[model samples]
Target: MYKSQIKIISVIIIALFGFILFSQDLEANSMPSLDYSIELQHDGSGIVTEKRQMHLTEGTEVYIVFDQLEGSEITDVFVSDYDEPFTYQENWDINASREAKTGKYSLIPTDEGYEISWGIGEYGDHEYTVRYTISGMVRQLKDGQSMLWRLFQGRNNLPPKKFSITVTGPKYFDPELTKIWGFGYDGEIYLEDGQLVSWSNQPLTGRNHITVYMQFLDQPFQPTLSWDQTLAEQNHQALENNSYQNEDDTTDIVAVILLCSFLGIGVLIVILASIYTAKRNKAIRAANPLITGIKRTEMNEGKVYREIPYSEGNILDVAYLLQEHGKGDMEAYFNAFLLKWLKEGYIVQLNTNEANGDKLKLTVQLLDSNTPELEQQFFDILLSAADRYGVVDTSDVTRWAEKNYDKITELKASLPYESKRTLIDRGYLYNEDVYFLGNFRAEVTKSSYQGEDLYNRLIQFENYLNELLSLDRVNLQQQNINEDIIIWASLYNLVEPFVEKFQEVEPAYFVTHHFNYSNIYLLSLYSSGFSSGYDQAVTSHQTSMGSGGTTSFGGGGGSFGGGGGGVR
Candidate 1:
């Protein structure tokens, strides 16, 4: 009886093992893949050629879905299996038997989206190339142009084992200016050979889709579809909790040391305190004049003005002075506003936790304060950039600036004129005749007698701030250096150097004083980050593909296109 039972068990094990091997063989043979090449025309139309390697058994047809087109339409669809191309059937019977539907395709328009269906054509393993043209694939945004598309849906019944997408536009995609991001599947996307290419790394299973978002600084195609709003900000926000967020590579060495230390707890506390001091000193050293890349105005030492130029100490007036005479760029204008806001309690900087890895991170809160009557609009714009919690961060500012580019540009263009108007009202500016071509002339706004005197005073004040970098602690103390003077120095791009000098003299200046050295540093960092990072972040797009790390086998929200197909 025991021998008979053993023989039966052996037979059952062999059968199960053979079945497992057979299933693996079947899966290996049946695995499918897709490659998409999209060529975008000058008028934003797209010619998409999908090369699919699929294994078919007794199935009658295969199909692809397109939805959320936003008035876009698909046309000129052709399907081939490297043999005779398939014929278009006016009314494709999806329920037809495999033999009846051979060498035929059709476009079925549903209320939700369109399905492009094609026959199997006696396939075991077949390479099918399906071509289609989509009108208005790219859209004109309020600030720029963008293309947001989902090549396929996550809920695809037979998701491809692998997929590749290559997109080419009317113009070469400049790597520095063109932004591309992929969502919904584990893959890599990059600009190469004047085009954008993306591919999947893993075989997609339950709810794995492919969505792509692309933007161009210089429009590569003239878009026909128009959306009267920017898509970048919302797209960026969608990627915040995704893998695209900046990764923290630093390990907690201190924690490891504490865990392994045989020393007393007091020693650990002392070590922590020393680390704190070293970090503070490091931040101060980082504030060195040479490290602050902003160029300062060079002035004659003898003409250094020790007094403030404008009694009111308006940042706008200082901005005007810098724009008219000093080496101030758009950054300087932003810095001037930031510093002024920081000093007058219009904006308050919050302390960030270093242990949380947000060291030197800048965050500000917009307070309810009455702004300057002349600059009320500017303040309102600033407020518009803040979040629901009244907090302002780099991302918030970047998004606001990108979306309101025209509004901000118009406001900034009016600054010089507004400052001049204020000066004229105060009897410091006048319209004067200027010569052109030695025959014609135009009356231009210029400094009057009083304005010229005030300009000299402003130059002298800037010179004084420049000299502070060279002065010793004792000599620096002699100069009337107040918050107002420091804030005004930002106009001349001297605030960074001033911070470095102050750090050198009084190491505890930030600690003991109500003054915000951090505000200056943070705003400067914000400005630099904005110029580069903002363009990259706020102008890009995203979809909910993964949850911060692992693959999200759910749905892809915030993307176009829906549904997917398999051999039916």
Candidate 2:
């Protein structure tokens, strides 16, 4: 009885082991096989042909996904079986409820690539041939044309049994000059009668894809300069006409001489008036202790001199203050604004734990609740979204800009329009209309402004800020007052006398002290009360497939089509 019981247990264990081995064999057989080929052209185009074979179970359906080449215009896509042709669609969602109805196969376009699904009637063996033409596959190098051909990066779900590629180009192409690199499988390339051919028959295990980089020996084709030559000839004729006019216009030349003399006299009068006004203002400022007190208080407190009756709410106000103080250094004023904000607790520096001597490795973060609306707009809409943790890291800002490009563009387009409307509503501008009598009468209108020179200067200041924001953070962070010192001096000429006096009082301290303090003030004001990064951050969150040319694929038991697939 004991021997019989042991025999029964042994038979059960043997049967279980056999079943596991059979299942593994079935999984291996289910993977699809691919055979691919391509023909190249000198004008950076290619015609690709692929033959695929897939094995399906009794109730399973197979979908073949193909990755479209980047920057290439694909056309003439065709899919066929041994007996009949397959129907295809472009840019179709695979998850959508659709049916081939009667056909054996159907092809659909996806964001990353294309998908081809076919029903296996008997679940034995199925074969399909796909063909397509791609234009602009070759990239232009400095001296010649190069092509980076990638395969097996996409459609990894359907593993290929054998893959082959043949590149046929111009006779001038030399295989010796062509360099190739393989990613997944080691492949061989040989020049056969002036044509470059490559093939691989290894199993794609522990590999992503294969990339072949080929540089042609021949120089890139260049068209003759017929249009440029014509343009040069036209420019020469214009110069000849100008020379002829110079010889003929004696009366016009005399009129020019008179105009120049009058202009020179006007310039001299303006310069004399400017010199007189400067001396007079200097005398007045020297006598007035109130103005002197304000400058002294700003230097001591490291904030905008609120006692001067200049608005301190917006960047425009800062520009007005600088202009009124006879200081043209926007950079200095901006630095002062930063310092003020820091003092007000709008922005705080978070110290890094990493040690780098006494040099501050600090990231700026918004802190206070009393940020001005304009500053809040800049902080929430621009700066905060740049860093993940609301810390203003320059590198993070660049990465954020790349990911949220649409938000950047929308802000750029809308800000100027909104500013214009605000200025108009504030009585800074009036609409001027002009009527033109053409084939059809029409009216053209534009904003006409009154003589508020400060308002115009404020507009220019805003333009400068926009230009700064548009720059990459690397360039923006490198900006310092010394680079544009001449422009700053002109802008701050009103405050130059006071600044000189302050410099004399503390000869070595003025430049470093003022600049550093001002920067802190500006940052604090800019980031105050803004927790969210960009105003459009919420709206910008959506699905994205990323930039690679590869598509992804997955198989669900019920339906063959769903999910995207691509090649690298």
Candidate 3:
């Protein structure tokens, strides 16, 4: 009805539309990116691999154009069929580190966009293949093998990626490859055979990804064998062919397996119970070690200890040992250390006062006395004992002081205990304990506390202003899934391979891929193992002594060590 009003409204509408368009363009251009990286460490044990997130936009694509995969043999390709927050990216770029004798892959752009020409052509002994496409995963088969495949709806949104894979292994056995599906971005798929697992949540975005993996073959021969030989060697049936088939033997074998399974479950229960008991305590490690000469922030000792327990005192204590090994200083490192050891229940607090009369004062407490040098000495002593007694190095005789010495030395050292007992022969925590552990190869000296001969306790003190006005309790949320169950799953995953990698029923391969989506991401432009892939001095580790080589096999074994290769 009114021309002026109508004209004004129209102008506003036009401006609003333009703003919306501009915002969308900005979002598309600067969206978070994912880089798909596959790392392979060459310790004869096998590949220790990982993936990465790269810088990307809605329409941007990265291609991994590798000219060579340098190792004694490409035993297995490290790929995961995970989805959301993590899907695999395609490899691109064609320059060789060495020669022009090798060329990059060819490309053919297509209709909807450019269809990446992948895994089709062979470049050389060195090759490039589209391991898997991240963005366009349209059809996931129903066999349920992808590590990124989800079973719950809210976990992740399917990004519709796809690939038709055809792998003909130099086979001793080949199972009819099955179709895997029913993927929940944050759930599991339970088949009569195996299951897929994950640890993240997602409503996957435009450039986000998920990953799935194939099975692995553990036959020592498969890495170099053509397929049939690998199968023949892997499918060895000595036990099946044995002449020991008494009905009694069948009964005995069944009985033995049952007994072992029951025993295993019992052990698992004990471990789970122990860990649960450990975590539920909600205790920060003993923080008897005091902070000296700091006047910045009034550090909540509990929070600081939970995150970084090592002291920055003038005295050279465990904190200094950590510094020697690259853990940061009192300002940076101790805080983090405390956070991990928070539930360990070992910290203590010293007295506090005011600095500027308005600010808070602080006193120094000494907690950890073990130094890095001490830990090494413990190891050295163990090796000397091993050499003297003629015990195999495999025994690691010096490392086993758990319930006994663990409580005496490590536990006491972890607290505000005055001194480690000097009586080594009477089992008092002493230089003798170190001597005994070092001699027997039993770890008498726990890692950080292995050496405590470094402090004079002449540390100074300072006043720190408390940052928080209120020392509120931190609300640490519990994971919904029983951590015990997850640990069981992870441990089994880390252990069950011997059986799976050796079984010879049909054509088969199994791959176990896990995503540790903690805030701890692979930070450096971090390439591993030097040349083609990446490897760094592993900053983190599995805590227990029982790592890779402790499994007991039934019969005699062949010499199975292989030479580790260098990057060309």
Candidate 4:
């Protein structure tokens, strides 16, 4: 009887070990899945509802966390097990260890996010559902409404098995002009059943986020055509009448006599004066023909080859040029300087690789020494702003701007004065201020002296470069730099050839990774017309979101969906 009992005990222990291993394997292979749906209205408000499911073993407790959304009021929180309601523990201590908990479930609030805990009574697998409502998700625009949805926040450890978001709106809503941006992941937006705009991602893992932006037009666009026969007839008659002219030949003999008498006296005076002046000029020219010819040549050259006296092949010059043209835009300024630096060999492109279908990575090195004072200053500022890794990536330009925001602001503030000083030194300006008096003149002229209108400055710079390079303005316009990439390349290509004509050969150096010249190229292109369109879009979007602006959902400091569960 003792031997049989030992045999049964051993078999039971073996079965328990096998069951434990199987449960561990199952937990490792499975993850929770989530689904979200948001219903929006035209008045800048919306509701967000979601459902999630996960599997757990018996006695294992799971915690569901919710991340707070910015500019949103969350309410109507509900949690349940499948279709059944689960009771929550009151007065639960969040600081207590997970193993110390004796309750079946608890909802505890924390600084980072809310935690919902549940103990599994008996489970091979289980599913839980959560739902919440978010108000003020949409922003009111002048003509319509806009919404920005951040799809990935508050997610940790729970690698989504599948995730989807659907946004439904009124029947008049159009999804064609919707804009979507994804970080660390890619997603697609499309119309569903003509009224809903849906965005979806599946099997997401490892910290990913997405943003969806949509603008709804207040009214549907309708084209109309109407022609007025009577108006056309009137226009034709007006054109015919204006095309004809009548000549008046009536003469006044006394007036003609007076006019001829004055004209003859003027001619006699001019002839006498011309003869006297010619004789004096002949004597002066005969005395110094070489000097006269040199003076004349200099005057003609000044008209034909008017050079922009300021330095052109450096970063500061580009900044000055940009400000002069009223561009004052930081990205365009950086892009212009980047082109100059690349051409002057201050920055060298070392290697290139395709990062993805739409992205390119370039390795670059910054050469030390031998740059202009201003260029070196700008270069050092950039070097100082490098990441902790001691290297700069082309993609980090925006980050660089953010990290050195104060310096950048100071640089922008001093740029106008520096630009004026450079111009004054070059004799472009007589002084800091040029004044014009009118009957109703008041205050200062901010546009010209204060660097307000950058577009005008750009035109002036363009004209200056055209004359300096002896380029045909008509031909340059015909090349259409905006549409022709070859022409665009050729225009900037002038920088290197011009510099090489004057500078010494030097080893090129600058450090960079994933630097794509196209980014800089596109930036320079903005100097033409694209920048205006970008500004308009940004302005419109900002105006729609109101003064405080629409906040990014997952960017808040508090935890909304940051807490998760672990298997025990």
Among the numbered candidates, top lDDT falls to 1
Give all candidate RMSDs, comma-separated.
Answer: 23.4, 28.3, 30.6, 31.4
lDDT of 3: 0.24
Clashes of each: 0, 32, 110, 27
User: What lDDT is reached at residue 159 by model 2?
Assistant: 52
The segments of candidate 1 whose C-alpha lies over 4 angstroms from its true place after superposition are 1-31, 237-556
Candidate 3, residue 272: the lDDT equals 55
Once fitted onto the true fold, the runs of candidate 2 whose alpha carbons sit more than 4 angstroms away are 1-23, 26-33, 58-68, 89-109, 112-122, 154-156, 170-172, 220-568
Tens digit per residue, CA lDDT, model 2, 195-303: 6565664654323344444444454433111122232232223222222122233245444655564566557556655655565445444433222224423443422
Report the CA-based lDDT of candidate 1 relative to the real structure: 0.66
TM-score of each: 0.48, 0.33, 0.19, 0.34
State which candidate, 2 or 3, has the greater TM-score: 2
- Model 1 sits at a Cα RMSD from the real structure of 23.4
lDDT, candidates in the order shown: 0.66, 0.42, 0.24, 0.43
Q: What TM-score number comes out for model 1?
A: 0.48
**Against the correct fold, how does model 3 do in TM-score?**
0.19
Looking at model 2, how many pairs of residues clash? 32
What lDDT does model 4 reach? 0.43
Q: Which sections of candidate 3 miss by over 4 Å?
A: 1-200, 211-568
Worst 10 residues of 3 by lDDT: 532-541
TM-score of model 4 (CA atoms): 0.34
Minimal lDDT window, size 10, model 2 = 552-561
On residues 131-242, what C-alpha lDDT tens digit does candidate 3 reach at each position? 3322211111122211111111111121222211112222321222221222112222212222222222332332222322222323212122122222223112210221
Displacement of residue 39 (Cα, Å) in model 3 is: 19
State the displacement of the C-alpha of residue 343, model 3, in Å, after optimal TM-score superposition: 33
